[model samples]
Target: MSMTPIVLDARTLKALAHPLRVQVVGTLRRFGPSTATQLAERLGVSSAAVSYHVRQLAAAGLVVDVPERGNARERWWKAAHDVTVADTRTLDEDDPDALDAYLRSIATAITLRIQQVLGARSAMPPEWRSVTDLSDFRARLTPAQTEELTERLHAVAEEYVRQHPESEAGPDAEMVSFDLQVLPDLDVGDRS
Candidate 1:
C-alpha cells in the first residue's frame, strides 16, 4: 500500500475537529481496513457509535469503505491516506478563530496520545523503553529554512516506512508512533 500524506483543507479540518473522528481516522491508519464492530471493540465504543463517526469521516473524505473486504452485512472502512498534513498557513487569514479551533483540536489529539504512551510505558519491553524518547529542542531559522527542514525530516520518515513496510515485518515487530512538531517559540524573550 502506498502511504501518501493527505493535505487537509479548511472544510476537512473542521470536520476533523471532533475527538471521535480523529480517533476513528487514526485507528484506520494504524490497523488497516476494519469493520465498525472491530473498531468499536478496539476503541471501547459501541458499534453504532463507530458507524456514525465513520460516516462523518467518509463525508469529510478522510476515510472510505473497503467493499472488497466486507460482506453484505458488514462494511469495512479504511483511511483514505496514511498521513494527514494540516497546513495552518493555508487557512484564511480573516478566520483566525477557525485556525485557533483547529490548532486546539490538534493539540488535544496529541496530548491524548502522549498520555496513552506515558500510561503504557511501564508495560513496554526493556528495549522499547530504552528507545522511547521525549525531548525538546529549540532552533532559530528563517521561514524558508524552516520549510526545508520540515520537508527533509518528512522525507526521511517516509523513506523509513518504505524500507520497513509493516506488512512485511515479522510478528515481533511492534508499531511505534512517531510524532513531530516544529513551531517557533512564541515566548522568545522568556527563553534562557
Candidate 2:
C-alpha cells in the first residue's frame, strides 16, 4: 500500500467541511470499506444524504471505489489515508479564502474527535486499575527515516488492532480509541 499522505486541496478540504462528511470518513477509516446504507445507519442519517456526501468525497479523491463481494448495487468506500491532513503550512498564494476554510474544517474535525474520545466510555477490563500508564518520549531522526518511523508505528498499532478487530466485538462494547501522530523534532534541528 502507498504510504503517501493524501494531500487535501482547498476544494477537497471544503468538501470535508461538513460534520456528516467527516463522520463518514472517520467511519470508513475505522471500519474499512462500507456502503452508504451502512454508513447512514451508523451515522443516523438518511441513506440518500449519505450517498450524496459519499459522491462528494469520491469526487474529491478522499475516497475510492472498491470491489464488492456480491451485488453491483453495493457501493463501498474507504478513506484515502489512515489520516487526512493539510500536509503543509504554505498556503496557496492565489487562494487565501479556500485556505482559511480548509483550516477551519481541519480544526473543527480535530476538535470533534477530541470531544468524542473524551466523552467516550472506556472498555477497561475488570482489572483495569492494575494495568495502564502513560508517557511521552522525544527523539531525533533524519528526514529519510520518517517513513520507517511511520511504518514501525503502524505495525505496532496493527498488532493491537489484530487482537481486537471490530468484528469480534459485541454490539454494546465501548470503542477503544487510538491516536498516533509523528512530526519532526524541530527543537533539535540545526539551522544551517
* Candidate of highest TM-score: 1
Against the reference, the lDDT scores of all candidates come to 0.83, 0.72
Candidate 2, residue 100: lDDT: 68
Ten residues in sequence with the least summed lDDT for candidate 2: 126-135
**How many clashes would you count in candidate 1?**
0
Steric overlap count per candidate = 0, 0
Give the per-residue lDDT of model 2 (tens digit) for 1-192.
324366677677678767788888888987888989999998789999999999998998888888654366787778787666564444456456676666565557666776654454275454442333334566666666876887798899878767776668886555666655666666766755
**lDDT at position 178, candidate 1:** 80
RMSD of each: 2.8, 7.0
